[model samples]
Target: MSVAIPIFKPVSQMQLTPGSTVTIPDVTWEEFESILQELGEKRASRIAYNQGNLEIMVPLPEHEISKDLISDIVKILLKAKGIKYQPFGSTTFKKQGTAGVEADACFYIQNYQQMIGKRRLQPDDPPPDLAIETDVTSKTTLGAYEAIGVPELWIFDSGKLAIYLLKDGKYIKSEQSPYFEDIAITQIIPDTVERSWQVGSFQALEEFANLYLSIIE
Candidate 1:
């Protein structure tokens, strides 16, 4: 009788965890869907899938704080301006035979009426008019979202806001928002965020409401 021993080698695949992003290249669409299925709900919240590439991110405290603040401010501004909107926070946008992305926060401004009272979304549902992403640990790319055809993207990075407009199947850095065409976000949002850090969201939101109201008035 003879005994045989097998040698093991270290695997190189990335292991994702909180407060970081893991990117896996050359992934198949089926494999991506299986990963999403395995993640179920909670874990899948932080996943983004591109063409043959998967990126998983864990939001830090700062990331969450900034995301919520940014979302709250946007809502406040919308209300102040008397604009109709529907908040679709982090709703997973998955396209058939294409990429999928979970934005930090999303909103239906121009298309709000279209998604009224909807519970579940289909693959063919119109994408959100605006999606806000907080970039603290990892940069959010426009490629995956381009496939989804999200019209406007707001990236809050390093205490600054950058707006991108989707035009002709690509993203272009823009000075004004497509939805809020007249408002100058770069002038207001940064200062409002800084104030929020100094004196809670409540006070900051109040101040932002007044600022927006003044502009529209």
Candidate 2:
């Protein structure tokens, strides 16, 4: 007797516009992985999967600009302070059978060396010390990072930067970064973002670096 194999219908590429989000319900992990693979790195950069639902987002120029500028500022500060750090931009951090997220930018600060030689990060390993979300369009809920147990998260939206510290299995909004306790994100990032439009990102970064130096010097 011959057995028949059930064939799943091909999932179509859902059209995505800049600054837009599309969520598909009842998606399996396997299906989500397939979709990610199908979308490839370029198109799948901002996708997230939680439980049985998947959300794909396309960031606008404003979003990308802000994300890059903020990341650059953070890097400059870390360097100036002689802090050991590593940046993992938009890397998909996922734990099987639970949830996954592609942070706008992530960093290993206190735990940079632990990820030096590893290609893929597993759930059992140390999670990135910080995860950043630049939310010009779609807002990212804490549920995604909470599943992976990221210790700290920075969310920038609507000309304000909010810091969240992971405490007791939940994220509580804080006024400053848990890692960089002395720095005030709200005081610096919003103004820097506004200045970037006038002076451009590179020059804006230089200006911010100088400002950071003046503060600590």
Candidate 3:
């Protein structure tokens, strides 16, 4: 699954026609590689002290679910369908242009590996087909994925989910999957946002998936 990244990229690529509005910094691929290496080393150190739990850095939020009930409920339902899932993992690409980005939760019908210039994420590497993000950080991080070419992006912020699918070199709102074809937010996200008036509306999403699944099957 390929997607657009929000970074400044060279207009030299024929397909990526230069836009008078956008200007990419002319940094060699070597510079990006070195930056990744340094960041990985420092982040890896902090990750070492923490085990079992996922933490990229001490101050940064851990790979956490704001709603554990919703997380567990959704995973259980998806697993029943035999779906493969991974959370917050990096996927790098090949050749001179590449990037390594981690997502909050990603779904894959199948998995792939990461191949960097001097490094690789081996057979055990998991590159997800669909990635979800909790947009607490600057929206700029979203562009990083666009630049690196992630196919699907689901951003949840302030209790709303904004989804995008890469189409024709840009990310646009999409309700359906181009890769899975049948998969959509409703299939991946629990419909808890619709039922149980006992809980506030914002909190209802936790019940949507579980309730919908029970009704369907």
Candidate 4:
């Protein structure tokens, strides 16, 4: 006699509220990929898969605002330094059967030349130089990023920014970003983001740009 196995519902059939997260256990890599296809590219939810656990999170408005503000700050600094960068916002990055994650924001700076005109990540391609996450909805799954070997990760949570650098196959908390080693990014980023919430994004950026220029000069 054959027993019936339960089939997982399609991701489209699910309803996830903002600032909520859902975890599905024992999901195979094949199933994970299938779910990604179902979710499509235009969705607001973010996903992370590790080993056999899949986590999906719906970000809040505050989360989106903070991430956009932070990413803008990064771009401003990059432009001021005359650094070339490619921003891939919330792109899904996978490491075959091991792990996969969609970062809140990611950038290719050191390897920007290699990523030119690339649609999908090739197996030999290096991961993004920087990945950003806002933990307003749920905590980011660092294991997925570690498995994929992302060199740097920044997490904004509780009105503060935390930088993690990948070293020797593990993530180590760092005081500053290697890309912006000369600048006090930890303090500047948090302050700028907070000011944006209070005054406005445009005014905050203008003020921060002036301050950054003074510091660099």
TM-score of each: 0.87, 0.89, 0.52, 0.93
188: Cα error in model 2, Å = 0.1
lDDT: worst 10-residue window of model 4? 134-143
* Candidate 4 wrong stretches, greater than 4 Å: 1-8, 136-140
Q: lDDT by residue for model 1 over 7-57, one digit each (tens)?
A: 733222345455777777887888888877766675523777778877777
Q: Model 4's lDDT to the true fold?
A: 0.89
Whole-model lDDT per candidate? 0.79, 0.80, 0.45, 0.89
Candidate 3 lDDT over 15-128, as tens digits, reads 322211222244345654544454554232121100111113222232244333334544655665656554333333322243334554555545422322325444344345
Regarding TM-score, does 1 or 2 come out ahead? 2
Clashes of 4: 0
- Per-residue accuracy of model 4 over 77-185 as CA lDDT, tens digit each: 8887889999988889989998999999999999999999998878888889999999833333798998999999999998889999999988999998988889999
Instruction: Return the candidate ranking by lDDT, descending.
Output: 4, 2, 1, 3
lDDT of 2 by residue, 1-217 (tens): 9999997654444666788787778988888888877877766348777777788788888998999898988888888778889888888888786777899999998789988877777767777899889882333346778888889988898888988889998888899875567777778889999999999988888888877777855
Better of 3 and 4 by lDDT: 4
Error of 3 at 90 (Å): 4.9
Which residue runs of candidate 1 sit more than 4 Å off their true CA positions?
A: 1-17, 136-140
- TM-score order, best first, reads 4, 2, 1, 3
Q: Looking at model 3, which ten-residue stretch has the lowest summed lDDT? A: 45-54
